[model samples]
Target: MTAWQSIPLIQAEFLAGRAEPRVVTPRGDLAADEQATIALFEQARGSVVFIATTERLFNPWTRNALQVPRGTGSGFVWDNLGHVVTNDHVIAGASGATVRLADGRAFNAVLVGTSPAHDLAVLRIGVGAGRPEPLPIGTSHDLRVGQKVFAIGNPFGLDWTLTTGIVSALNRELPTDTGAVIERLIQTDAAINPGNSGGPLLDSAGRLIGVNTAIYSPSGASAGIGFAVPVDTVNRVVPRLIAQGRYIRPSLGIRTEEQLNAALSARLGIQGVFVLEVEPGSAAERAGIRPARLGREAGFQTGDVIVSLGGRPVRRVADLLAALDRHAPGDAVSVTVLRDGATVDLNVTLDAGR
Candidate 1:
C-alpha cells in the first residue's frame, strides 16, 4: 500500500487516542505603505458614486410604458452643494438618472449641464445633512510617467471599486462625442472598464488628478490602457457648465470637414483645413473668406484653405478648433489661408461657439 493508504488508519487511531488538536491562530500586520493605501481608499470611497439611468420604452402592442434600464456608470462628488460630475457618454440619451452613494443612499439626479466635446457632465442632487465631501482636486500638469495613481469607480456594476496603476503616458488626445478633440489627456494603466466612466483617478494622497474616461481594448474590457480627462481641464470647464448650462467654445465661424487627414489633403493638393462652407453674416464671411465651390471645368475648386489661425498652423479641423479655443470671443485674430496658391492673411474676430 502506498503511504497515502495508511492515513485513514492513522487518523482513526489518533482520534481514538484523542490526539491533541494543533490549531493555531494566524496574525499578521499590513505594511505601513499598505496601511496608508487602505486609509486613502477609505477616505476617497465616500466621494465616488454609482449612476444608473432609466428610460421609458413604449410598447405599442400593450399600449403601456415600460421603464427599462438605459445605462450605468460612475461619478464623483464635485462639490459640497451636491453637484456630481460624470462622463457625458454615460448620460447620453438618458432622460433621467439616479445617483447612489457609498453609504447606500440614492438620490434622483437632474442634469445641470454637459460638455459633450469634453465628455463631461454635471448633475445636481438635492442635499441633506449626509452629503459626502468632494474629492480634493490635484494638478495633472506636473504628473510624470510611472507615478503611482489610483482609480475609484464602479466598474461593471461593482460599486466603489478601487484599482491601482501608474501613469502610462500624458498629453494624449481623445475624440469626444461632438467630434471635438479633448487634448492633454492622462493615460494610465488602471483597469478602467465600461462602468468606470467619469470616476476619479486619484493620486497617492487621494487627490483627484483625472477623470477616468476611456479604455483601449478590443474586447470592450480593460487591456491595461486607460485614459482620463485631466483635472485641470475639468476645473476650467465644470464651473462654466454649472453656471451657463453649456460650455461655450470659441469659434472662428467657419465650417470644415469632420476630418481633414493628410491623405485627403495630399490628394486635393492642400495642406490645411479645406473650407467647405462659411457661415453667412459670420466673421469668416465678413472677412471675405471664400468657401469651396463646384467648378464646371476644374470639377471641384477648393476654396481658401485655412493654413493657420491666430498665427498657429492648422492642418486639420481639430487643430483649427484647438487654435481658436485658445482665444476668446470678440478677440481679433489673424487668419491665414491659401487662396489660389497664394497666402492671404485676413483679420477676423472670434465668435461664441455653440
Candidate 2:
C-alpha cells in the first residue's frame, strides 16, 4: 500500500483540488491486464463535475420514472448547505439543474440567482440528504503573475477534472454575449473547457481565488488564455445575490465624455473626461464637484470633471466607471480632480444608481 502523499505535484493537485489524471505505476511492473484495469480505475476516480440538468418531461408510460438530469460541468460544492456557485452561462437555459458531487451523489439544485454582468450564478443543492464541502474563499487582489492556480470542474460530463496553470494576467476586460463589458477579470493559463464553466479556480494553498468562466479559443476549448471572475468580485456580488436577488451599483452622478480631439482638448486646456453636467443633489453635487466653467471661456459647461475616485487616478470616463463599479451604494469615497488649474479633493457619497 502506498500513501499518495509521496508524489508532489500529483498528490497536492489531487488533495488540494483535481489537477489532472496521473498515469500511475509508470515505472512499476504488472501483468498487462492488471495494469490496464488499475489505470482505468484511477482515471475514473480522479475528477469532479458540475452540471445543470434539464427538467424532465413526463411520458404517459413512465410518469414515475426517475430520469437522471444531465450533469452540467466541473462545479465544486460551495457549502455544506448544498449551495453551489458557477458561471451563469452554464445553466442559462436549463429549466432543471443538478450538481453531481463526488461519491456518485446527484442532488436537485434550484437556481437561486445570477449576475449576467459577472457571469456568476448560485444554486442550492441539498433538500433531502446531502451536504458537501465548501471551498474557503481567497482574494485575487494580491495574486501575482507567477502564482500557481488550479481549476476544478466537470469538462464534458467528466467529473472532478482538475487542470493546473499560473495566473497569466490580471485586470482583463472582455465583452459578454451582450455588448456590456466585464471588467477587472483574471486571465489565467488554466485549462477551461466547455464543461469547466462555473468551477472554482483555486490557489496552490487550496483556497478559491476565482471561478472558471470563459475561454479564448474559437473552437470552444482552452487556448492557454482562459479568464475567471476574480474571487474578489465574487465576494462582493455573490453574497448579495444570496441575500437579495440582485446587486446594487454605486455611482458618481455626472455626464462625461472621453477626451479625444485636439480642438476640445485645447479648448478645455486639459486632457480628461469632458464633464457635460452633474445631476443636482447627486454625490458629485454634494461634494461640491464644481460644474464645468461656463461663461465666455468655457462652452456650455455645467458638470464637474471627475479626475479620480478613492485616490485612484482617473483620466477617462471608463476609469471613473471602473472605480465606481468596485463600490456599492452608500459607500463614501474621496474624489480628487482638476479645477481651475488646482488639484482639489472632495468627499462624495455614492448613490445607488438604478
Candidate 3:
C-alpha cells in the first residue's frame, strides 16, 4: 500500500478504537434534606429584595447637585401593602433608594420610618399586583442554639445568594452608631458580608427569624460571626413604623442623659442611671420617681438612681431603654431605684414617648 493509503487505514483503526462518551449516571432524587433546603431557598428568594441607595452631591464648581450611588444592601417584602423592611444604616444617608425584586421588577422606595436604636427601617414601594408575598414571621425568643439558619441577601452586590449556617448564639448585644446597644440579637455562623445587611435570616422552616445586620470581623468581611436583629424586635418595630412613620418606644417619662449619668455614677461610686428630671404629669411623676436636685452644699442631691427596670439591671441609659423596649406604653413595670440610701421598688405604667 502507498503512504496515503496506510495513513487512511491507521486513521480508521484509531477512530474505531477510540472510547465513546460515557453514559451519564442518573442523579436520582436529591437527598431529602437537600431538597428541603432548595425548596426553602426557592420560596424565600422571592421575598428578599435588593436595595440600592443614592446620595445627592453638590458640585461647588458647577453649582449643580446630582444624585450618586451611595451603597447597596438587602431587604424583604414586609406586607401586601407595599412595605419593605431593611437596616436603618443601609439607607441612613441616602437621598433616594430603589428596590429590585427577584422577578426583575424595580420600584422606587419611599422612607416610611426608621428606628436607629433598633437598626431597622421601613420603606414603602408601590408594586401593584406583582408584589411578592411577605415572609412568614418567626419568633426569636424560642430559638435554640445549633438550629439551622439560612441567609439570603445580595452579598457583595451578588444578588439572591444563599448561605447556610447554624444559630451559634442568641441574645447577643450589638452596639449601633446611634450610641445605643441593640440587645437580643441573633448570632449565626453564616457567611454574612457587607451587602448582606437588611437581609432575612430564615429558620429551617424558612420563616423569617432575623435580619442580618452586622459581622464581627476585623477585616470587614465574614469571619463566621454574624449578628442579626432578632425578628421579635423587627415584628414589634416594623408595624409601628408602618403605622406611625416612626417607632415610639415605650417611655418611663423620666429624663436621663447618658453623659451626665456616667459622670454622676462614677463620682458617686454607684453603677446605675441617674434620673435627671421627671416629666410633669408623666408616668414617672405619677409613680413618684424623684429627680436629682442641686443641694445647698453645691452638690447634687441625687433623688433617684435607677438601679433596675423590669428586673433588668440598669447600669447605663441604654440598659434602661432596652428594658423598656420589651414592654408597651400601657404596660406596668417595676422600677427599682436608690433613694436616700434605701432601695425602693415602685410600680410605674409606661407612657408613649414624645
lDDT tens string, model 2, 66-119? 555544665655656666788888877667876666766777778888888888
Give the alpha carbon lDDT tens digit for every residue of 319-345 in model 1. Answer: 676677667789999999999999999
TM-score of each: 0.72, 0.62, 0.73
lDDT (Cα) of model 3: 0.91
Best by the lDDT measure: 3
lDDT of 2 at 128: 51
User: lDDT by residue for model 3 over 67-176, one digit each (tens)?
Assistant: 99999999999989999999999999999999999999999999999998889999999888777999999987668899999999999999999999999987778888
Clashing pairs in 1: none
**Model 2 / residue 271 / CA error / Å:** 24
Off by over 4 Å in 1: 1-11, 15-28, 251-328, 331-348
What lDDT does the true structure give each of the candidates?
0.88, 0.72, 0.91
Worst ten in a row by lDDT for model 1: 255-264
For each of the candidates, give the backbone clash count.
0, 21, 0
Who is ahead in lDDT, 1 or 2?
1
